[model samples]
Target: LPKTSNREAQKIVLRIKRKCRETESEEVAVSIGIGVATKTEPEQSIDQVLKEADNEMYQNKLSESRSTKSKIVQSLLNTLTAKSNETKEHAVRMTKLAFDFGEKLGLSNSQQHRLSLLATLHDIGKTTIPEEILKKPGKLTDKEWEIIKDHPERGYKIASSSQEFAVVADDIYAHHERWDGSGYPGKLKGENIPYLARIISIIDAYDVMTHDRPYKNAISKEEALAEIEKCAGSQFDPELAEKFIKMMSA
Candidate 1:
């Protein structure tokens, strides 16, 4: 409420702490720290320090991965999917790549539109994963892979429950399925895996390959595209692969 700036001509700050629920029925201490200090001030004064403590007084803040005002529908999920903002951009780029790939494949505008939405939120299920598992810096064990693989399904349920996004729910579930029936959560290969989902899968793999993740360093675009080409018949749909490569080349 009181500022050191008024007294000492300082910079401004607003520290906020509030009791928050990290999850349903899970109450956690949420702290927000704000401060105002003079550029010439030598140190924090008792009053300024105590003023910073009022964050707990309001009890009305929520922790968001992004700013409070976000036009992006999936920003919340994006934050939970990976450790840093870099990961968020990577996901966004992949969504763009997926939509562009779909466009190149002659998908209808509406299909591309919905595909982009689904792609953006594909990893929403990652929210349910523990932070340790999501932020692991080494190769995931087989058991971990098993847990991670369940995300497509979990994402489906979470998105479907939103009611507003029910259509994309199916896409979330099918994104992980490969054309050759080698995918997970009921592998409906080829056209059976929703077209948009298939579109996203190709681009998703490409982006994931090119970006550094918890267990891998980023490779060059050329090298990542090469891997896509190499895995065409196995990891990705050959048709989608060709289209995506052509899109990237363009």
Candidate 2:
């Protein structure tokens, strides 16, 4: 193949990748490697070219596997968002806010990364709830409330089931735990709760308060912030909530 043909092949591969991103199941990761044997290189056998291309493709696949796993998880989150009242945009906003809070708190790069994932998938377990129960506009009965509260544990199970998400499993499980040991499946208090989970709790609540839900109208941002501040000591880590508020204000 000529140099022009090689360029054309590369262009075609890139086009395929671009198309994958635009596709509805855009989370798919595509890898392509092309090797050309030129007539000018008579000493190079077709087998050698094929072997080189295969090796490059293998390396590409290895590198892309991590990205592929991330995309698949994101796709799952998208499915959850679509099924529930929560929109994909809400997840995106929360991820950004969580990452910002993590950075402001001087968390490590890896911790911030985990926080981003936790923020997106914190409510993923809600998928297990019946659609009618999830979308019910009226107050929940004790049994329905109990079922809804089980989502954290269910989310933990889902996250832990996959190696890619296992890092954030505990965070997802404890996201609903309270600072005063009054909340959720574990009733964890203070530093007993995962720090990332604590951060997520504050941000998640704020997002919920400020966003419209099937059962309620959206509140003002000021009102939402006030509610978060009011719940700081009881529902959220006070110090982290303070820092989060400061970050948002900034």
Candidate 3:
């Protein structure tokens, strides 16, 4: 959702396109399926997620059926590549911001890289959710909300299933956990939470609040900053948030 109230919802999709010399040096035709939300802000209420997911799936089938190589795939790849430009210049911008925050906090290069990765693909779990649930606009039934909440677990499963990302699967799975130990999946607190995940979460919240999305209006930078400041020691890591805010102000 581009902009929404506590009750608003919107479906988001991702697409992957193939590029191989086998089909074309410039492009390759590859079969594609609907993209998933893989990442969502834990701050979003359960009601909003339920409403948005139902609609996302419908569009997924529509876009996928365009071909065994559906526009949906094209769309997802386009989203991955293009939507960033259209949305907030690029997820890269936020990624760099994450790294900068890492630097300010005195994290190592490898740790910064990990924070960048987490910032980039944080929503990857949304891929496991059915597009039907993702696109729905009306209030979701309790059963549907259950499916939406399962994305972190499902995404963790997907990442763990893949040999490549096993290193960071745990971080991705628990990025939503709060500093105060009020978060989901584990309720871990303070330094008990993984540092990279905590960093990603802080930046993720900053991005969500500062930008306009399908389900919610963009808050002013001042408002966004205040929100983060207020959440320090509650939803955010106090020391980390301090470093990040200073970086942003610079």
Candidate 4:
């Protein structure tokens, strides 16, 4: 322990974790959180050293928890991304657009963070849908369209499954809701729709309009903006649609 630096201590902890995983059984998953605290002076009491180590250990545990949750969330995203490259790219573009729009709307840091997550995971439920339906080149039949419409509820369930995603679960569920209460999966109308979900709804429409899909060709940004403007009161929140248009136009 005399010559051990923090780096060496971390290395030891990692080795222990590796060994634990190596020997873990199906019935017993292995995991550990460790911390290192060095005594810089011989005069430091044993109690003080122990307290420091304890604090570090608690911090390490929290870090591990966050890291594990993130891995679980990323794995879901990976699954979604593997199924559809367009969805992956759409999420990336929507995240930036959502974050930027949130800032423009003067959303709090936490609100913006949640908006980003909502944008990224909004279509995750599509992972469960058949690839043929997702990438179909022609118009969907009523049944296929019904299956497509179920994604918001499906996404809500998926997002709700993990603590990491629980914060945005409602937003994901309501993302497809329209301003006039015509949307499915609850038909939430106006401000009854969650604010973040409202933002996502606009962003989702805009992104879809401007991007090519197997079923439809991409429209010009100007044309998309006009369509958004036309649907301002019915399909989208009027004020938000106006603001989004201005933001994109700028």
Best-matching candidate per lDDT: 4
How do all the candidates rank in terms of lDDT, highest first?
4, 2, 1, 3
User: Mind giving the per-residue lDDT tens digits that candidate 1 earns over 155-205?
Assistant: 888777554566798989998998889899987877788877877787788
lDDT of 4 by residue, 1-250 (tens): 6688868887888888899768755334455677778777879987897798889889988877665655556666777777789999999999999988999999999998999999989998887799889889999999999999999999898777677888999999999999999997999999999999999999999999999998999999999999999999898999999999999999
TM-score of 1: 0.67
Better of 1 and 4 by lDDT: 4
How many residue pairs clash in model 4? 0
Q: Of 2 and 4, which scores higher on lDDT?
A: 4
**For each candidate, what is the lDDT?**
0.69, 0.80, 0.64, 0.88
lDDT of 3 by residue, 1-250 (tens): 3444432222222212332213432133444344233226868775666555556656765564444333332333344343233232435667888767777778887777777766655555665566656546466779987786675666566556444455567887888889999987778888988878888888778887877654466898888888889999999889888877777777
TM-score of each: 0.67, 0.70, 0.61, 0.74
**TM-score quality measure for candidate 4:** 0.74
Best by TM-score: 4
Per-model RMSD to reference: 12.0, 6.5, 19.7, 6.8
Better of 3 and 4 by lDDT: 4
Model 2, 1-250: lDDT tens per residue? 4454656766766786677666645434454433333333768887787777677777776666666666666666766776774656678889988877887889998988899988778888876788888778888899999999999999898787667898999999999999999999999999999988999999988898888887778999888888888998999899988887887777
Cα deviation at 131, candidate 4, in Å, is 1.4
TM-score of 2: 0.70
